[model samples]
Target: RPSRPASRRDDALYRKADFPWYGLDAAYTGPRWLMQAAVAGDGAVEHGSLGHGEEPSVRTEGGADKER
Candidate 1:
């Protein structure tokens, strides 16, 4: 446990932000510094944004909203 205790880490093991210029709500694969994968499970929402910018887009297997 951290010295300050883990609020989210205990809940979902997701680390806090301020780790980088941009980070996500959680740290799964890598550091939460890139645009979110656009999925559920308390993941980051935007890229290079201060929580005020647009969210990252994820392509569905159905190809309804495929990425360019």
Candidate 2:
């Protein structure tokens, strides 16, 4: 296996680019920031959601997402 990325930004970038493939077998749409909200400062927080397949439909709990 390749060596891990050495920097936080690089790792985050790597994950951002690579995360989608993590779902290739699960019929999932993401490891994406499914919900994000601004915090009090210049910072923000996000929550990610992964979808497992349920034939004929794609759904997310909390009604947070719908397929386009």
Candidate 3:
């Protein structure tokens, strides 16, 4: 089978905005397993959830919550 093309939404959004921005949502992927692993490793995956609290509290970098 052939691979799908990457979505242009992130690129477009970044270009449209001038400031340095970061995504607070889960990473995009074609496979369900990839998505599951990402969320499992990182608690701040934001899978249909608004998250626990404010920005600083939830804006952790990669799987920090799992450690704690």
Candidate 4:
């Protein structure tokens, strides 16, 4: 039997955008940058978020009010 193909990186699957991407606003400047993005089927930017400070660690919190 043949071996399975290697998986691609998460960033490799990200789509490119022509428009500028901003984090928060012009006044608030901190250690924030482009984390990831979500695009439509037509390759349009639907929505995304910016990462602040340090990289987040994965954790499971069993609560309705807890943030994902």
Task: List candidate 2 stretches off by more than 4 Å.
Answer: 1-5, 18-68
Model 2: how far is 5 from its true place, Å?
A: 5.0
Residue 49 alpha-carbon offset, candidate 4, angstroms: 1.1
Per-residue accuracy of model 4 over 1-68 as CA lDDT, tens digit each: 00122124323323355455555566654555445567789976666655665545763465467566
lDDT of each: 0.33, 0.34, 0.29, 0.49
Alpha-carbon runs more than 4 Å astray in model 1: 8-18, 21-42, 45-68
How close is every model to the real structure, measured as TM-score? 0.15, 0.22, 0.21, 0.43
Instruction: Give the winner by lDDT: 3 or 4.
Output: 4
Q: Which portions of model 3 show Cα errors greater than 4 Å?
A: 1-6, 22-68
Candidate 4 TM-score to native: 0.43
lDDT of 3 by residue, 1-68 (tens): 00122236433332343333333434433221111111224333323211122224343468546844
| Local error of candidate 2 at residue 46 (angstroms) | 21
Give the least accurate 10-residue stretch of model 4, judged by summed lDDT.
1-10
Q: lDDT tens digits, residues 1-68, model 2? A: 01322355434433453234233454444333222222334332222333233322444566656678
True lDDT of residue 6, candidate 1: 29
Q: How far off is residue 52 in model 2, in Å? A: 35
RMSD of each: 12.4, 11.0, 15.3, 10.4
| Cα lDDT over the full model 4 | 0.49
The candidate maximizing lDDT is 4
Instruction: Judge candidate 2 at residue 34 and give its lDDT.
Output: 20
Candidate 3: give the clashing pairs.
none
Highest-scoring model, TM-score:
4
